[model samples]
Target: MSKRMLALACALALLLTACNESARPQPSEGAAEIWFAVGTGEDGGPLVDGGGAVAPEYRALPDEADPVEERMAALLSGPQSAELRSPFPSGVRLRSWRLEEGVLRLDLSEAYGGLSGVDLTIADYCIVLTLCQVEGVEAVDITVEGETVPYRGRKLMREGDVVLSGGEGEPVAITASLYFLRRSGGLASESREVLVTENDTLATAVMGALMAGPRDQEELYLPLPEGTELLSAAVEAGVCYVNFSRAFTEGAPQSREEAARLLYAVVDTLCSLDQVEAVHLLVEGESLDRYGGVPTRNPLEKDYEMAGEEKPAAASGS
Candidate 1:
C-alpha cells in the first residue's frame, strides 16, 4: 500500500476511537442517590433486601471550637447574673465583642442614653473597670449598632473625662463640661483643664470650684444665672472681694438656691487657701446683693433671699 493511503487509514481509525469514547455514559454532577434494602425473612441467614447493597454511613468531622467567646461570656456574665446592667438610668446594652489590635471592640445596643456633662466622668470609670478585668482585654473600643461610639471632644475609645491613676497612686480629681459628636459613633467626651493643687484632697476642692463656675472662664466663680468673668481677688476691710465682668448679668439662669450653691462652691474653694476669712461678690468692682437668703458661712446652706428685694438679672454670655 502507498504511504499516503496508510496515513489516511490511521487517521480514520483515530477519529472512530474518539467518537466511541465521547458516546459512552458519564456520571452526573448532582449528589448520589441513596438506596435502602427491605428484609426478606425467607433467606433465614439474616435478611435479604430487594436492593443489591446498602448506602455507606456519612460521618462529618467535628467543627472547630471557639474559646474566646466562651471565656468572655463567662467573664462578663457573672455566675450570679446573666445580663449586665448600667449604674445610670440610661439603659445601655452590650451586644457583641471582638479582639483586634490588642483592643476589644464591644458592640452595644442603641438604647444607651449617654450620661450628661457631670455624669460622664463617673460613667467612664464604670466601663473601664468592668471591661479591663477580662483576660486579654487591656483597652476597649465601644461600638453602638455596628458603628464606633461618638464623642463631643475627642476619640471615645481611648479618651474620657476621668484620668486614671498614675502607677500605684490614687486617681486625681478633675472636672470639665462634656459634649457629644453624633457623627463620631461611640460616646461623649470632654477636654478638661488640670488645676495644680497641694494634694489629692485639695485637687478635689479645686475641681468642685471649676464645676460650679462658668464654662468660658476658669478663674471666676459666680451664681448660676450670672455670666460674670472673675477678674481678680483682693483682701480689704477683712473681706475677700471677687471682681468680675459686667457681662455677668446679661441673662443668667438659676434659682435663689442654685445661686447660693455657686457662692458656696467658690467660698469653700477660696477658704481652702490660708488667710482668707470672708468672700464678697463684686461685679465690675462694685458690691452686689447677697445670694440666696443669708451671708456665706461654714457648711454653706442655700437659703439666701434678699429682704424685700427683686429677682437678680440674667446671664448673656454664651
Candidate 2:
C-alpha cells in the first residue's frame, strides 16, 4: 500500500477500536456513598467527633463534613416550624439516617407521635421537601426504629407500621390550638377549647362526620373541591363502603395519584377505627374498581405489625 493509503487504514482501525471500546460496558462510577457521623445539636452546631457506619449507596448523598443528624434537626427546626407541629408537639428525634443514590433514609424515634392524618401528610411533605432541597437528594424513605414507612402503597424497603391506620382512643380534654406559619418568622398559635379524643376509631368518626356534614363548608375531615357531595357510607363485613354523588366525582379535580391519595386519606381515616378493616371507594353507589381503577387495597394498608399490637395499651406520645 502507498504511504497515504496506509495512514488512512490506520485511522480507520483507530476509529473501530474507539467504537469497540465505547460499546464495551463500563462499570458505573458506582453509586456515590458517604458516611456522616450522627450528632446532636448544641449551642454552637452539630457536635461531631467521627464515628458512624457508612451510609448505604441508595441513601448516600453529596459529602458533607457536618453531622447528618444535626443538619437534619436544624433543617426541621428552621423555617418549617408550623410543618413540624401538626402532629402536636415540636420535637422530632432522629434515630438514624443514610443516603444512597438519590434517596435519603431517615430513621425516626417513636417520640415523634400525636401524628394524625393531616399531621402525617405534613410529615411526608416536610421530609421530601427538606431532603430534595439538598443538592443530591431526590427522594426520602422514613422509618421509625427499624421499620420503614411504606409510601404509595408499596414497600420499597423492609416492612413497618404506617401510622396511617390503626390508632388507639384515649379521650383527653386538652386546650386545642392551631398554628400557622408566618412569612416573617415563627408560628402563630390560636387557642381554642376543642375536645381532643384519641381513638383507633377516631379517624373513622372524622370520616363519618365528613360524609354526613355539609359540602359547602370546610372541616377537619372532608376538604372538598368546588362542587362535591358526600352521598352515603356503610360498613359491610370488614370493608367500609363510602359512596359519593356524581358531583363528588365530577367536581373534584384530581390526577390518578391524587385520587389514589384522596382515597387513601379516606381509607386511613376510616380504617383507624377498630371496626373497619378496610375501605372501598365508591361513586354514585357503585364500586370505583369498575370505573375509577381504584385499588382494592388502598395506600394505608401495610404488612407491618402496628406499634402496639403486642402491647395493646401502649400510650402514644402526645
Candidate 3:
C-alpha cells in the first residue's frame, strides 16, 4: 500500500481500539467506598450538622485478611482526594478494635480524648458511617484510650442516627408538653415546640428541654439543677433509660418535697410519649436506688396526679 493509505488505516485502527477500551466494564472487584468529612463547600451531608459534614470516596479495600480492620486503616490513612479530610485528629490512631453481637468497638489513641462537643460527635459518626458498611457491624462504640467518655450524649452510634441526606434533611419539630415544678407546689405542663435532628431522639430532646428550665422561670421551678448533663437517653421495651452525670445527684434538692418534684418532673415528661411506659433514672449509668425520698431501683411509672393542683405524696416514705 502507499504511505498515505497506510497512515489512514493506522489511524482508523487506533480509533476502534479506543472505542473498545471505553466500552469495557470498569473493575470493581476487591474494592469498597469509605466516607470522609467534607473539608470545604456547603455541607448538608450525614452527621450532626453544626458545620460538621462528611462525603464519600471510592477506594480499593486492602487484601481481605480482616475486612473491618483493613477498612478502618484506610479511613485512618486519610482520603486520597483533596476535597475530603479524615475527621480523626492528628496522631489519633486506632489503639484497639473488636466486634461483638453486631457492635463494633473502636478504641483510639489518647489524642482523640481531647475532642468534645460537636467535634467529638462528628469524629464519632465519621467512623460509624465508614465502618458500619462491613458485615455484622450494626453499631459503633468509640472510646478514647479504652474508656468511654463520661459526658458523651450518646454511647452507641448507629447508621440510622445520621444519614446521607445530601443537604435535604430537615429538622423534626415537636411541641412536647414538658413538665416543670409549679412555684406553689405541684407540676405543670408547658407546651413548647423543640426541633430534633436524626441524631437526637424525642426522649433526648424532651430531657434537654427540661434541663434548660421552663421559659417562664418566675412561675415555674426548674427541677434539674444547672450544669446537669443528660449523658444519654433511649427507650427500650417500654422503658426510657435516662442517664445523667454525677452533677445531677450532687445538685439535687435536699428537701424531700423538692426532690420528689425533681424526680417526677423527669418521669412525667418522658412518659408523656407513647413509646415510654415508665422512666428509669440513672446517675452516671448506675441505677439510683433512691433519689432523696423517691424509690427508683426499678423503672417508675408516671403519676397522672403528680401534676395535679396538689403534689402527690412522695413515691417512697422517708
Candidate 4:
C-alpha cells in the first residue's frame, strides 16, 4: 500500500478509538482519603492517624479549598473521647486557611495565642500536619490578625513536624451557651466548655450533646428526659430538622413555662449554626404538631420573648 494511504488509515483508526473512549460511561466520585493529626499517646504530642470524608466528591484525591472549613470544624471539635486530646486550646478558631503553590497559610483568631510553650508548639504542628495531609500542601505559615508570628522556633512548619505531645496535659475545650432552668424562676444560659466528640453532623451532634444532660455538679439543668435519643438531625434552607425518640415526649415537662424553656433550648442551640436560622422538632423522623405549647406545625424561629433576648447574628462561615 502507498504511504499516503497507510497514513490516512492510521488517522481514521485513531479518531475512531478516541470517540469510543469518550463514549464510555464515567464512574461516580468516591470518598476522599484524609487524615487528622490528633494528640495521642501519653505525651499529648502531635500524632496523626487515618480519617477520611464520606462526601462523594472527596472519594478520591481532593483540592485544598474543597473542604478546608469542614476539616477545621473537626479539628476544633476535638478528638474522640478515647483519642488523645486536641492540640488547640478553647476559643481558638481558624479564621481562614488557603494554599498557594506548596505553602498553606492560616489566619487564626486572637484565641490562637491562648497556648504557650510545648502546648503552643504542638498546636502549630497539628495545623501543619493536618493540612499537609492534603496532596498538594507541603509547608504551613500562620498569621494572627494579618501579622506573621513565630512557631516552633521557626516561622515555617512542614508536613513531618507532627510529634507526640509530651508531659501531662489536658485536652482543648470549646464552650456552648446551653439554656437551662433558673432555680429561682425562668430561663437562663450558661457557658460550658468540654473536649467534644462529634460523630455526626454538627446539628445532630449539638442535639446529642444536649440529651447527654448536665455533668455532675454542673449548675445548669438539662431538662430533656432520659432515654431520649437524637434519631437524626439535618439543617437545610436555614432550618434544622431534629428527629427524636419517643422518650423526648414521655420525659418532657408539662407546665407551660418549663415546656417553653425546654423547647427553646433546642431551638436556640440549633440556630447557632450558620446554616440554621430556624428549626423543626420531630419525633421518630416525623414532625410534631405540638410538643411544648409552642406551635410546632411550622418551622420555629428564635422566640426572643422566651429566649430572653434576640439572637446576635451570622456569617463567620468560620
Candidate 5:
C-alpha cells in the first residue's frame, strides 16, 4: 500500500485500539441475525436492515469451509423487506470469494458495475457490513469481472476506501454528537448512536458515522463529496488532524460561503469529541491553508463556530 493509504488505515485501526477508556458494549455473542446496509424507500438512502443471516447459527457450520462465503450467500438472498434493497441484482453474482490476511476478497459479475452514484453507495455498504462479520476478516476488497472498478476516484479502493461495517456476531454501540449545516445558520449539533467494531476507535467511528450523515433527517447535509476518503487521522492533546483524499478539496464548492459551511461541518463534527477541542484538515497529508478560497487551517477553536455565523468575505485562517 502507498504511504497515504497505509497512514489512513493506521489512523482508523489505531482509533479503535486507543479508545478503550470507558467500557464499550460487546457485540452479541449469539449473533442470531446479520445486518446489511441496504437502500430503502425511494429517497431514504442506505439503511441497515437488509439480510439477517441465512442460517440460525453461521458459526456452527458442520463442515470445515469458508465461512465468509456462507455469509455472502445469505447476503445474495437480498433483504427480507421489499422496502429494502441489495446491490447484487439479477445478473450480478458472486463469482468468487476468499480471505487473505485480514482482507476479504470479493469477485462479482460484471453486472456489479451496473450500480453508480447513490445506488452504488448503498450497495457497497451493504456488502461490506454483511461480510466483515466473519472472524479474521478486517476489511473487504471488491472487483468486477476480474478488474478493480474505479469507485470514487482513479485510485481503486484497495485499502482506506473500504467502508467500515458493523459485524454480525455483535455490535458495539456509542453515541456521538455530529455537526451539520442548518439553513437557518449556526452549526447545529445532532446526537447520533452508531454501531462499530470492538477495535474501532470512537473518533474514527464518529467520523465514519458523520460521513454517513445524520440519519433519518433530510435537513442536514454531508460535508464531503461522495467518494472522499478519510485519508488519515490522529488526535493529539486537543487537536484532531484528519486528512482526506484530493476528492475533498477538488472541484471546489459553488462559492466561499458554501466552502465555509463544508469546512465547519467537518470541524464541528470532530470537535464534538471530548479529546478534540480543535480540528486540522488536510488533503492527502499536506496542510492546506486554503482550498479554492475557503479557510481550512485548523486548531480551529470551538469559538470559531459555524452556527448562526458566516465566514467573512476575506475568510482565511487555521
Candidate 6:
C-alpha cells in the first residue's frame, strides 16, 4: 500500500479501534440484498430513470466472513442479472473498511476514482443504500485510495437523501428576495418573482437568479461574475451549502470591494430564506481559506451592514 493509503488505514483503525464490537451489526445467516446500477429495461432497452438508477439482487453471505466486507465485495464483483451492471470500474478493489458508531467508511483502490457526476452518484449510493440495510449502519462514507472524491455531491451519504421517481409538481410563481451589488458599492435586495418546480429548491432558485446577474444591469451590478454557475445548493440545519462551478473563481472580481460584495450578496440572499441562517460557499466543490481578500474559512452569517446604502467594509483582521 502507498503511504497515503497506509496513513488512511491507520486513521480508520484508530477511529474504530475503541468502538464496541457489540454495537456493530453482525451479518445475517441468509441471503442479503446487494444493489447494482439498473442498466437496461426488461425488453433489453436502456433505462431512462436518470443515470443514478439502481436495482437490487440477493446474494448469500458467507457464514464465517465479515458481512460489510462481503457486501462490498459482491457489489464490486458486478451483477449476475443481465439487466444490471456494476458501477465500479473493472480494476477497483476494496482495500479496507471500518465501522464506528453508525458510520461505515470504505477505502477502495485507485480505479474507483474514475467515477464522477451522475455515474459517481449512482456508484456511491449503490454502496450506501446496500450497506445501510445492515443493522448498525446508518450512513456510508467512501474514499478512493483513501482520498475523498473532490467533486462528489456529499461527504457522508444517508438513505432517503435521494428518491428515484418521475413525478414533478407544476411550476409555482413565488417572489424571492435576491441580493445584488449596488452601482456605487455594497449590496441591495431585489424582490423578483421566480417560478419553482418540483425539481427546484427556493435556495437554488435564488442562486440561479444571482448567477444570471441582475436583469437591470445598469441599475444594479452583478455580484457574481459573468459565466458563473451554481452547481448545487442545499440547507442543513441553518447553514446553506452553496457549491459553484470553476467559472466562479475564474471570472471572480479582482477588487476587494467587489469581492466582498460578491461574497455577501450570496450570503445575504440565501439568508433571506426562512430555513437558511448562514451560507457556506465552495468553488468546484472544494473549500477555500480565502476568496481573494475575503476570509471564507467558516460559514458566514448575513451581514446586514454590508447591505444597502452602506459602502463595503474594510477587510477583517481576523
TM-score of each: 0.34, 0.31, 0.45, 0.45, 0.44, 0.44
The better candidate by TM-score, 1 or 3, is 3
Worst 10 residues of 2 by lDDT: 10-19
Q: Pick the candidate with the highest TM-score.
A: 4
- Model 4, global lDDT: 0.54
Better of 2 and 6 by lDDT: 6
Per-residue C-alpha lDDT of model 5 across residues 105-141, encoded as one tens digit per residue:
8899877775432234445655665566667877777
Whole-model Cα lDDT of every candidate shown, in order: 0.37, 0.39, 0.66, 0.54, 0.54, 0.66
Candidate 3, residue 127: CA error in Å?
A: 40
Regions more than 4 Å wrong, model 5: 1-169, 292-294, 303-305, 308-318
* 112-215 per-residue lDDT for model 4 (tens digits): 65443234544665566456766688898888877775333567777554322212222222344445665555555544443323124445555644554555
Candidate 6 lDDT by residue in tens digits, 1-318 = 443322221220101011123432344567787877665432222242332246667788877888888888888889887757787766778899888999999998877775543356567767887899888988889998889986565689887654433234323333445688888777777655444343344456566656655676787877566656667777776788898888888887888778878888889877765346678889889987887578897999888787853432443555
TM-score of 1: 0.34
lDDT of 6 at 13: 10
TM-score ranking from best candidate downward = 4, 3, 6, 5, 1, 2
1 against 4, candidate with superior TM-score: 4
Query: Candidate 1: where is the Cα deviation over 4 Å?
Result: 1-86, 146-175, 178-208, 211-318
Q: Per-residue lDDT of 1-318 in model 3, one digit per residue for the tens?
A: 543322221210100011122332244765666767655322112222233245556677656468777788888899887756677657778888889999999888877775543345556766877788888999999888889975365789888876333233344332456688999988887765444444444456567666666888899977666567778777777788999999889988988889988899989878765446799899999998898688999999877787773333333432
Better candidate by lDDT, 1 or 6: 6
What is candidate 6's CA lDDT for residue 126? 78
Clashes of 2: 13
